[model samples]
Target: MKASHDLSGLVKFLSRDDWAFHFEEVMGDHFWPVMDHFDLDHEEINDALGDHWAMTLWGCAFEDFLTQVFDPGGQTFVEAYLKRRSWKESAQSKAYMTALGTSVMSLYEASEIVPGKSFLARDLIRGGEPVLISEGTATKTLRQWERVAARIVPLGGKLIIAGGLLPFSQEASDALLEGFKALPGKRRRSRTQPLLDDEMLRAAAPLFTHAFLFDVLPKALGETRPIIHNSDGDEIVFHEVRFPLATGITRKDIAWRLQGIPQLRQENAQFWNWLDERSQKGPLKARVPNALAAGTTMEDGTPVLGNLELKGRFLTLMVNSAARAARGREMLENVLGKMVGVPLTTIQTIEQMQEARKGRTKEVDDIPLEVATPLVHAMLDKQYREILDQPVGMLGDISPRSAVGTQKGREKVAEWLKYLEFRSASSQNPHDPMTTYDFGWMWRELNIENLRR
Candidate 1:
């Protein structure tokens, strides 16, 4: 049998009537957060999370139980088990049991994963140099920079992860770290001494399980679909309203009429943008203000309420919400009264647009490599130039420049930068322009280059 199967057998052995109390105590602590958060009892939680996750949680508790000392003399379940059943197990199993008796569970950041082989794990909670771990099953699925709360044990001269591993999302990891820092006696520590001692980490093991559940339960229970709204607090729905121009009207006439309105900015002969002038002045003073007065802007601070483009005889107006589309249509009708014909409107939900975008391939012309490369880079540079000063939803709707002014905000910005860099590097196409783009400048701009690792 595999070593993990033997570990499972040990867990089962400890769950008998003689050791039921300790089993209940550890499992109770592990599952209490899920129960308390969802207001569900033991059976209901199992029904909600299903058998797979429930057993996974149980395994986490079992691993935590291995490190606990039930008696004043420091005897643990593994020690007690070996005392009685040592003769039945092989030498390797005995050694494994002994290792488990002393193993401390802590969170680790996984990297350089090689499927079906191994990966490098750096302890995030205990703070140590990264060590190569020979793991097969987990390496199949573990992503680079993913955090996992698990135990590493030396078995057969190789460090391997224990059976109980709880992978943590960035949100979960942040919650766990915050919870750890809020614990008594940890608040006064400095940066270099951020690592927790083995004893403290082991004692705080239940918090790791709690944080993971807090991150996962909402998603698993179907509560994570965000209700997105525009700055006007209107639920976002894409509205494409097309107004056909009158026979005698020309592009120049349309542009001249549009220019009379202060909100419209002419981009080209065929295009004009309906803009919110207030957004160009500076960052918003407050959220959820006048939607018409304070419209949405791109990352580079181009305040666009909607887009208008001329095609054949049709003048298409694309806006986010129905309210904006209606407003846009009325404004256009008033400006170019007899110059425009009847309008044709098409509406799509945000979810539908997203679904339609998936697997849709764009057709690119075969431009010369030398020309394409510089053009792509220039576009990217322009797009990201004012990104630091603009509000980002990922950084809690605050500008990165503003976010870096505080310690907690700085941490969030660092993680956001790392995520952006990771996604840019993960492009499937090697020749993709994004694959070669450097985020080093962005890190330097934010003054968090030192935390790039």
Candidate 2:
């Protein structure tokens, strides 16, 4: 379940309040040394400078410098902090993200050259990255860098990272490709060329007035190896796939058509029991087969082709292995094609049923509940025990039962209960599949009742 309001706003609120986090490291890295170099006339200020509280003044001054000297005003700092937030949220960490994000933003903004008044920003470190705001390639900045380089090249404190570490995703690769085109270099994708930072500085002498250094750990040399995933009984993988169903078939016809597959017949021995129970009469009636069963949720809460008033529903399939998933999909497509006669159109969604459900006024009972329930069970019987232990973001990045161990996690579990409550009370026109679900299992599994009290 999604939060009613986005969580990003909460991050921003936290970033603004935690000022010490942003400035603590930078004060030690640059401010104290810079202060030592400057001659102060005021004895009172000088006496207060040795105290730990003095760093607060240094941080304010640095922020002010970033706002005035770097020209993007103060917005660049905000953007950097947001990036920090994004990185932190992606992992389960919190503190460094907001603090470092804000610090990086200001670092970019305040990174310009004051000619002779302050040292060239590049002279402090080398490359401008993680976001560089005050980077300038002006003639004066270039000449100053040339002078600095002549002085420092004999000594080494820099290393050029050359391209990026690790592989780039397609979208990220595309962006880098486009960006590389603008730089003064050949855009060869396959070449593994390395240029020293000293040579690069000599080539593009007047770099941006960026003063930032990352405490980056070098990647271990040698071939990158693929990590092998070995799952114990406690760890199981689930795959959700879509399969096409044949049109003009009823619930009984569906059971027969799917049962026609040798794999389905062999894998599920309970299929006959379900079909026999659905055939039974009186109030002991079983629900209609909802293509499959409860363990696997349908894409749009659609019934099998037999009940379709407007169009056929896609069979929502799930399996634990890639091989089984693919085989199941191909088999379903092949078998349904034979039964339907018309080329079975494999659908990924049930938008047609969604539309049909919307226009119809009555709570149409297309299929009985008794028959549908057991088939759902047959689909998930193998994986049900492990499902409760899997961590979900909706449960505050903890498993359901684990969420009850702490007060904060319990609050998240309560929120999850509220979300399910919303689902229970709601419907997708007449096609709500949640009604078929027994949610009591969740409460009992998590041991999280008595929330109201």
Candidate 3:
């Protein structure tokens, strides 16, 4: 029988008069957060989260109830259910139930997932070696770096997660960690400190459901949008501002003028990069004899602000925001003078750009997979090689190379790597070259291959 069947049987037993109050208490604790947060009633929760998540919420609560201690002696709903229904359950079911009674609910980070087979679960709330979970269905759907709050119980010598599995978003996971840190009776020395003792985490398990719902509900209810923004914090809107060459002006004239500008770096005959003069001069340099001192800024650091290209009769500037397009237009006008005519602009949001790409006709001479895969891989290799030494916002603005120098930074880097791998694997097209690219080399290069597990 499936685990859900066994859990349902136990739930039926718990509905009896003798155990109903304990069941209600656990259910209330789990549901109250979502209800209170949205000012929702019991019936409205199902409407809000929909059937799938509502059932998931209930399953999580029921599993949490299995671990609850009812009295000072520590009797639990699982014990009560097994006492009345053990004879009806199979040996495996009985063992599962017995294990659930003692299991604790905690957040876990999944890694090395083999769809329809198994995955490793590293406890985020309680520090320990990762446990291998012999899961089938969840593994098929779970992404790498996905966090879930669940109970990992050993059933017949192999570890299996209990029926209640709550998948958490990154925001929810961070909130849950913060909630644990803020709980009374224990003080955490640092944000990276190991989680509270097992009993404390278990007692505060409802916070897991709360945090998950807090992040999920707003989006589910259409209260938020998945907004993408540029590093400047402006919503991303691609702008292509084109200027026609004035009567006698030619591409050569514009190229010559652009070459003389310090902010524009010519890439080829037709393309130039518009650079930001205000970007930081890379990371700090270490002080040494006859070397640059720490905190001393470099002279040649310029981040790309936009791009310029000469196509046919037009000089085109491409930027990610309207503000950048305006500034780029002014700069080009001041330099080109009567060499360029009045500008024409085109704007597209990310969604519009995606739709435009989908609507475009495919090239007749498409590259073969064998040729394309290597080219794409080569491009990605070059991109990531530079990324290794560049600051990543996710890693607290520290470069991955610098991050690996400390234990805490290494942990963050590992998580960041998992996210990159997961996103690559989740690419929409199965045949996309990115989907097949191996990130194992990245881990090895960073000397954190062992942590890939």
Q: What is the C-alpha lDDT of each candidate?
A: 0.76, 0.34, 0.77
- Cα miss at 330, model 2 (Å)? 18
lDDT for each residue of candidate 2 in 1-453, tens digit (9 for 90 to 100): 322213344334434644435444433443444334333322333353344324434433333222221223444343444554544343322332222222221110122234333223332223333221122123223221121211211102231111101222222223333433455653333224322233333322111111111000001111232222112111123445544445666545656666664333122421221111112111111133211111211111111111111124444554443544455556656766644432232332234445657877755765565676566544443343454575544554456677788887876765555444444424543333443444455566667654411
**376, model 3: CA deviation in Å?**
1.6
What shift in Å separates residue 305 of candidate 2 from its native position after superposition? Answer: 23
Instruction: List residue ranges in candidate 2 displaced over 4 A.
Output: 1-367, 371-385, 428-433, 436-438
Q: Write the per-residue lDDT of candidate 3 for residues 197-271, one digit (tens) a residue.
A: 767777786887888887777777775555654444555688999999998888898899887788886769999
Query: Candidate 2 vs. truth: CA RMSD?
Result: 24.1
lDDT string for model 1 (1-453, tens) is 455338655766766545778878888888876788789777876676789877877777887888888864568888888877777777788887788778887888886678899998888776757788999899987765678988899988899987778888655776788788878766345656655777787888888778887767766777457456665567678999998889988877887888899888676888878876554332222243212123455433445789999888788999988998989999999989999999999999978999989977765777866678778878778767678888776577789999999888887887777666555555676567776676678888889765554
Higher-TM-score candidate of 1 and 2: 1
Off by over 4 Å in 1: 1-5, 15-18, 187-189, 223-235, 239-347, 351-417, 424-453
State how far residue 75 of model 3 sits from its true place (Å): 1.0
lDDT, candidate 3, equals 0.77
Clashes of 3: 0
Cα RMSD (angstroms) for every candidate in the order listed = 7.4, 24.1, 7.6
Error of 2 at 4 (Å): 37
Error of 2 at 6 (Å): 43
- Give the Cα error of residue 361 in candidate 2, in Å: 14
Candidate that scores best on TM-score: 3
